[model samples]
Target: MPGKPNPVARLFWTAAIGCPFGLWYGPPAFAATGLALTLVLMRHLGRPRRFRARVRRIARAHAETLALRRRQESFSDAYGNRIEDGWLRERAYFLDRTVLPQIGPRFADLAESERNRMLAIVEAEAAAVALPEEDEAPGDGIDYERYCAERLARAGWRAHRTPPSGDQGADIVAVRDGLRLIVQCKRLAKPVGNAAVQEAAAALRYWAGDRAAVVSNAGFTPAARRLAAATGVLLLHHDALDDIDLAGAHRS
Candidate 1:
């Protein structure tokens, strides 16, 4: 009756809605019919290879994103460690990344000395507030490296601790009197040895600086003195500070 109630249409509607309900029940007919229809529709909509390719592309993109994030995190960790080390070399390396990028490409063409000048201004502007107290006893000869930095700064030079990995013997670097100089400071109570002079000479060669100097509270040994003279390394005795202005130079 009623033209058999359009059996195909009735079955289609039943399978469409009833398949979900069949999940809870035991109606294999509704599920099978719906699954078969879905497959037919997908086959007509697109080629299987195309769909598979799209899925593969998405997977590859996700992998690349993950790899990039990992690399960034690793770089961040290394940078943090370098800063925490509190070495001049470490600081330079970190600043090269964070500070250099902002000044743009013009800096790339500058020589090492010129580049250092630009960096000094930037570093000075961001100078940190020192702690309230001094760490060492008064007049107990300053750490030679720190002492040189203080002295040069007083002389209106921009001084910074340089990396010591292959330093050759230079402990500090400074720009002074329109010249860039590499300095080796010795805090011994006695005269420095010729070996130290050799080290300073090596450092000068390594840095290719305009000049090199050796500063020691303890005067230079005869051998050291001879080498310094022969090699053109400026020598400064500990008592030399009495003759120079050290207002901004490091103390304690």
Candidate 2:
């Protein structure tokens, strides 16, 4: 009994070997052993909870990253581009691909918390990306864009200003009822030319916009109007702005 350990002691030494026992002795050794065993047991018992939390964090982070990439892509599908709506771009993509369908006719409900959480994410990401400048419509180009955005918003669109430097061709993005329309606004004293319509068509391809348009406060050149008709790009002149329907643009 003095030189050889009992069967129980041998099992205690090895059964849960979390603590270093050889260097410990007396009641202190027993205390250390108990604490070690408690920790090991707690870890084993809480594994599922830890795993769930980790998975949730990873999923949220992944969603955020994808949203950011999408935002960048709007600027010529690269970085360092000028402004277009930062928020609507991200929100619309998720809304179309994920949110709308999941809650529809599934017998499943979108909890209020889930909706709020999504908004929070979109807002935070949008905010992190700085607007080109604090100044509103720094020049003629931006001024026309601002005008177009206001009119579009009044027409029930969720409008976003595309970045100027990296605009893939769209000056403003108008979204309504999950429909995305890319618009190029011309603030020239003369009529907008055919070039405007061509640029808008190219932008539609790059942005995958449902419809494209060239909007002018003045008027569109005859060539521009014809090209728009052929290419299916809407031409919004000052007089026709009143008759244009924002909701209908989404369908086009």
Candidate 1 local lDDT, 141-218, one digit each (tens): 345577667766776778887775766788877765666777787765355688877887888888777777777644
Superposition error at 187 for model 2 (Å): 0.3
In the order shown, what is each candidate's alpha-carbon RMSD? 23.4, 17.8
Candidate 2 worst ten-residue window by lDDT = 104-113
**Across residues 128-155, which tens digit of lDDT does each residue of candidate 2 receive?**
6543332222237777788778877877
lDDT of 1: 0.53
Runs in model 1 lying further than 4 Å from the true structure: 1-142, 239-252
Over 4 Å off in model 2, which ranges? 1-139, 238-243, 246-252
Q: Whose lDDT is greatest here?
A: 2
Instruction: Evaluate model 1: give its TM-score.
Output: 0.39
